[model samples]
Target chain A: MTSDRLAPQRVPIALGDRSYEILIGSGLLSLDGAWAGLPASADALIVTNTTVAPLYGAALAERLQARHRRVLTVALPDGEVHKDWTTLNRIFDALLEAGCDRKTVLYALGGGVVGDMTGFAAACYMRGVPFVQLPTTLLAQVDSSVGGKTAINHPLGKNMIGAFYQPARVLCDLDLLSTLPRRELSAGLAEIIKYGPIADPAFLDWLEASLDDLLALDVAALSHAVRRSCEIKAWVVGQDEREAGLRAILNFGHTFGHAIEAGLGYGAWLHGEAVGCGMVLAAELSARLGLIDRALVDRLRALIARAGLPVQAPRLGIHRWLELMRVDKKAEGGEIRFVLLDGLGRATMRPAPDALVAEAIEAHTAPS
Target chain B: MTSDRLAPQRVPIALGDRSYEILIGSGLLSLDGAWAGLPASADALIVTNTTVAPLYGAALAERLQARHRRVLTVALPDGEVHKDWTTLNRIFDALLEAGCDRKTVLYALGGGVVGDMTGFAAACYMRGVPFVQLPTTLLAQVDSSVGGKTAINHPLGKNMIGAFYQPARVLCDLDLLSTLPRRELSAGLAEIIKYGPIADPAFLDWLEASLDDLLALDVAALSHAVRRSCEIKAWVVGQDEREAGLRAILNFGHTFGHAIEAGLGYGAWLHGEAVGCGMVLAAELSARLGLIDRALVDRLRALIARAGLPVQAPRLGIHRWLELMRVDKKAEGGEIRFVLLDGLGRATMRPAPDALVAEAIEAHTAPS
Candidate 1:
């Protein structure tokens, strides 16, 4: 249990027939042995970004080629800005060009953006096909890669166009995070910290203790963080696979987070960074609603600031924030819905009154 | 059932939670009563093509407006050529432009092209939303609008990029097909002829007997055909929704049909036209495999020809036909698979040897 170098840990996502595992550890890309008996498709396509392909493209393809009759790779342009329909169609172009059939299995080999677009491509490719997530970035391994929410960004809203398409399996290689930038590493921590306020307070405390090791790229810390996050996500999704009810709790800060991303434009702030600030805003809103105390908000803000994520949100203004938040997919009947903490480690969905929403936005916005 | 005008007949597609009904009758659209309690979304969006919108847009909007808080319309350019990412995104653009939320319900109001694009749009819009199929064309009412297989075409293939998303309800108003052009009526008949070879031999006999009445757009004939086709489709999809096993039978001629559509360019021939010709090719292939006799092939050819669908297929060279069909989503392990008839009524999927496929193609091509 203590030894962590290259030892793969499997976390099963219990989704009945759609269930698969999240394999977390080091050197998973080169471990051809794990590739056995899982999705024995004759054809395989690996979708990655420009930054990731050159690093491990050949090795990944080589591993897949050992078992598959054919392996094709499509490297997309990097970053959140490219998560649009045009860029998404490029993967479709490659799949169609390769004459890959429905039996073809897609491997998404980058961060959340890559995993999302590839999962979506698999979902729509011939109506439905199987895909695996080889999420390289920590943000993906902990959050996006675990859940089946695959989407490309719409001009008006982030992730506004997508589907809840589950992957065949998820392989989270801890070694991949070694080369991730410090800023991205902190970004991933935002997601790790989110699990605490909404579902598990104990996980939040462990994250506080291990943030330093995770930021330093310690394999055990990274592995534990990814595995625990996936376990929580799997449990949540298993109960409500389609965000029917319980699943919305997992999107604790996502409503505010999505507004920020859409407001400032997608790439201006990293997704996890927006969510970090978003969680603070949600906590503030919770405090305003008399659900959680100010102390909890203060503690959350402190942990976020300490983790190198932004504690204060951007000044999108009350009106603009209201407008952008209304565009959220979670919103219904012109009412902006939010997932707020009932108390530390528990969440509930409710539509905040317009006045209170404005007040919360004002409280979160930094003085400029 | 006896009284023809405005007598509503419902065909329930039992898909567990995602299940919905297909309401077939005359004046179903204008009957505001039928629209009630369906998709009770605050926001309703009607996605129709330029051609069909002018005919019934105002009436449809009026019916939806009575129930919905807000009603919006996005009219795409008509035709199979427009059923791609560009046209599909126009719906998204309007959805975002209107600040429509997740609870918004979309109404697909046109042929298979419109129904398919709208369904896919509904599937991906905010990860999913409720949608109703108000199919105007015969092809859509009989086939595409029922099964929940929604897709947009890629440059390389028809229905290449899509999803398996069901609609909240399907309203096939027999009146909508009255104004349908003769060519499109024949196109719709292609899908009707498909049900016989795959599941129901009696439905085939009935279709053959009433071909003239259907071609003439008789209200009773149209109503019966739409209901029977949907009933067959519903039964098949209920057994196998995602084309895992039993659902493949629904794609009787689609493997070859898709190649025809892809090879000639998506809009060059109507989808039904391709399927009509493809059915002939499949029957010939079926005879080659000894799964069905020459009499059955001749019977299918006569019915397809009398229904005004193409009995002769395009002379795609053996190399080209092989290349194209291999790209079909149905193909597996580099082998071209076909849904061949086990007898007059039952269908089974198997890979026909390449030589037999080539020979069948040669047999079906015109003498010239």
Candidate 2:
């Protein structure tokens, strides 16, 4: 609404009283005035990883200083491997050591790993506290940072222990993505592409055409990509905040995606890459179930490859895939529930027969 | 209202779709029908403690197994001393080791420590899972189990880390009180006495009249005590489930009570014992603030003493008391917020003058 082209794009997620907004734009991390809308908090804890903190922590802290009483920065070790109980406790230790009370606000200022851990920390710090998501990666900006799914990985599974806690606000600075590595961008593109088959067909088509610009870090294309992905996720989260029914659809390929993450040991593959490959397996299973046609599967596969994501999943043994999938949060009664596309822009959750899923996995696994 | 006095009293906590009922009465633990309303799940995780498991774990498991395909029992170490992240993680470890899926139900079968840890475990397990409160201690039956404030103690504070996760149902069996040590019974009396000044003055009179029968575990007197306490707590929780405002009133004595526990190194003073003494201090503060008369404070003190609870707060030095209280869950923005009495049966939260609190502490500190 602010006709200033330099102004951020704002998307609202309506959850009644607990609603929040996702602000997408360029150079938000440096915009001091952008934080004016945050809840009146006396102190702020800026949580980021080693890599992102050195790059953006000071800038974000400087901007937040105008609003918060005190701004403290704690840079956790960089990457998904460090997302565990030990790392999570460090945040608690810092907050307690600093005498931050229940009303303190936490700022998550890095990628998905940092975002997820910070959000969970905020959720549990004093039973619950407010948090802001200042996501610095495409994957976090478009996916993890938007949904309010906060968790730390357990040795048995990824995000096995977590909370369905929402953030007070999400500031997605598209400029942050400019510093991201090429592979991580591709990884993020997988999540952006996720919106198409699950909720927005037009976004899917736009992604098909804008893949090159987005990969090249074109600002306009990247902004639109992050904006549209957030819109889809916001709508899904708004309707089903707790993933009771419709919300599970937004987790289109996450069930299989999580298995891949766990099977390979967390952080072996970036979350978005596992999801990218997971999406392919889901589409193939949908095709096998006669839920979707071969052309649609091929369309998704082609776009996935064009976006520089893995079109073929790892050759995890059938039993291993089954074992990992059974451990998913989406699962119920020991049955692995999956979100399958009824058609483009439509998703449904149901238990696919193990036999059919195994067949699809065998066909999709990369040849040894 | 089943005329068969043996039938349990059912109190419903109306949280719309997430609403649940609390069933209270004698010998309900042995009744097969008591667990019929629990969510239909293939597996159930019975989380008890070393103390309570020997007495009631097998009986509860037998009834649950009739409805669940598998019943797994995990008895954590007994006592408040074991209520920490280490013990809380044990519940998670057991759930994962059992391959318990999201649909699995958890039964917390013990006192306040077991119920708090188990409910928190359910809240964090795979984002969240359903749990039932099988409170065996009178303290839990009348207080912690009825409300959804589940948490474990942080070394820095009591109940510093946890979630407000409601259980599917709470079953309070008065029969279990038969085995309670006299000291534990007195600990529970503190919680019973709490409802008097904070919410129900009439209940205080009732407790005064029935203290002798209640101490002897008279079935009728015990049933009434549990039923009315749950009613008061349920009404409070129904209005303010998350302690946004009105709920803070429930912690009238807790600000100091928690300090007492943390100062004494948890388990040294039973939670209710700490609160018993805390209520006396809060009442004295109320009288000093001109909200209530001297007689009110004396009445509360006499009842607390008659219940065999400590009426004197540990001096712990004025600075130490303030330091411990600053870390309380109810504290916000680094200010120690205490739940104080506006008058009998009415509560308000505010900060007491440090000098006034210091004077009260000096007056109440037991000779050492």
Candidate 3:
């Protein structure tokens, strides 16, 4: 690969006043520019997880020490199960114990769970403080960390408690992804695939052509995939920060996906894995509703399975599936709204009849 | 009192798109205008304490039923002690159980404790939902409800976890104040007394003359007091929604006040009572620093005492006091910053020497 292909790329999130940049590159943790122009404060708190801390925590603290008088670290237990009030409170305790002020900056240094809890902590601590995201996992770097959607899951639903508070900046160091597990890499690829169907058909074509290279951790291919995914997400979030309308399209598969996560309980399935399977179900529902053809559903399901994601739906009972989807944030007045593909490269949110939804679920379910 | 004085006075908070009006009147809970034009939603949740639910819950539920298909009430155990994660979660449980959607509107139907927690719950649930403040106590009607400052106390400090989320509107029903305990009226008068020293001397002068009428719960005097307090707060918050610079002046006694609340444990002293005493100590510090003379300090202290608020500060050891102030949101880099008066009707935030702060504490503190 050319050196230029490995160089850092910057994507700007165009939110007025809260606008910030997502810097995607290799070896950003060591770069001085990544640490420059951050909020000037006496203290900086690094919030990460047990899984990712040992790998990169010390390096991040060393770089931050130059910018802040005190740099403290709080490594929470890894996994989505810990993404609750008890774990979130740990971040608050760390900040208050350290006497971190409102101006103190928080660095979120793990995957989605770490980024989420850290961001929510920053959002609530002293009513709000500046925070930067150092997203390491592919799913986080490509999707979750780029958007300002920060939250912790409640027992009833995933991401039920959160805020639309943007980060000061997002540093996506591709180098950190090197240590990520093989399954997580595939899980993250699911999100990259999602962008293609919902927003860009050309990107979908590229993904089909380059899926193997991306799977092999090809630097050039991974760079294009991440940059493109962030650009689409940043563009969508810019238009709808609070998910008033256009933003709903970003959750093309999340309605079913969140159901899987909540029904089986979070941590049983990685978020991206569930989203991957959920996308298949959503595409099926779209076809059943005549929004798209059956051919499109088959094509999407094939790609998800090829990417090492499950296309077969879980055996959550029909009534249970319907119940869980009803609590999805997109649901309104007890009606489950799915983000259906209007056509390839576009999406719309609407409700389908229960029988139709049940058929879609039944069509995709694995024989139990 | 004239009938015109009973008419609702609307004090608009100009926070761009988030702005809303604060309706100050005698019988606002029963008024049609108070419940009109709220966010059209399928559900409305009235979050109040046990104390308020018995009194105003049915009245509010009746008014809200006209606008919402589902009107749900969640009565939390009363008191500041319940302002924690457990209490905030009860609101979420009710919302999720009742299938409250993103468009759901929350009505905070009590005093500062209820307003703070309900506003925070709105700021969090499903990212954010609209909430209206039905502030019943004088303290909430005059200060807490108008500023968009919502929080729950952390174990380490008071209001340590929260958000700067504004309400859709604030309804200050003076009729509700008739049931307020004699001590609670004086507690609220402390906040009213605060606006004079920090922003308007004329209002302070008017308060001095009308203190008796307010103490007696005179409707005309109470209406004017609530309306004026809201207007001044609205003006300050409009300029600085977040407490960056100018907004710090609004916490003239809060640094000391928060220390007292946290030092004694939060429910020990009513928030306004602690603030009432905090103002006395803050004034003493200002005087010792030569910002104001001893006479001004004595004048303010006498007013607080006459209002039935304690002028003598709680004796939380001097070291513990400093430690608590250091954790205040205003503190930066472990240095305690106090909002001190430059002269009558104006305030500035600055750090005082430990000796001077200790001396001020000694002068006003109750003898152990």
Residue B174's lDDT in candidate 1: 84
Error of 2 at A77 (Å): 1.0
lDDT of 2 by residue, A168-266 (tens): 989888777768888898898888898999988888889889888887777778778888888888888777777678988877888888989888877
Q: What's the lDDT for residue B66 in model 3?
A: 89
Roughly what TM-score does model 2 have, to 2 decimal places? Answer: 0.91
Over 4 Å off, model 1 = A1-3, A251-269, A281-290, A293-298, A312-339, A349-368, B1-3, B251-274, B277-301, B310-339, B348-368
Rank order by lDDT, top first? 3, 1, 2
TM-score-best of 1 and 2: 2
> How large a fraction of the reference contact set does each model reproduce?
0.96, 0.64, 0.89
| Native contacts recovered by model 2 | 0.64
Better DockQ candidate (2, 3): 3
Candidates in descending TM-score order: 3, 2, 1
Candidate 3 per-residue lDDT, tens place, A166-238, comes to 8999999888888989899989999999999999999998998998888887777888899999999988987
lDDT per residue, candidate 2, B86-198, as tens digits? 98888888888888888899999888888899989999998999999988889989887666888887776567788988999888888777788889899998888888889
Candidate 1 achieves a global lDDT of 0.87
TM-score (chain A only) for the predictions, listed in order? 0.93, 0.92, 0.94
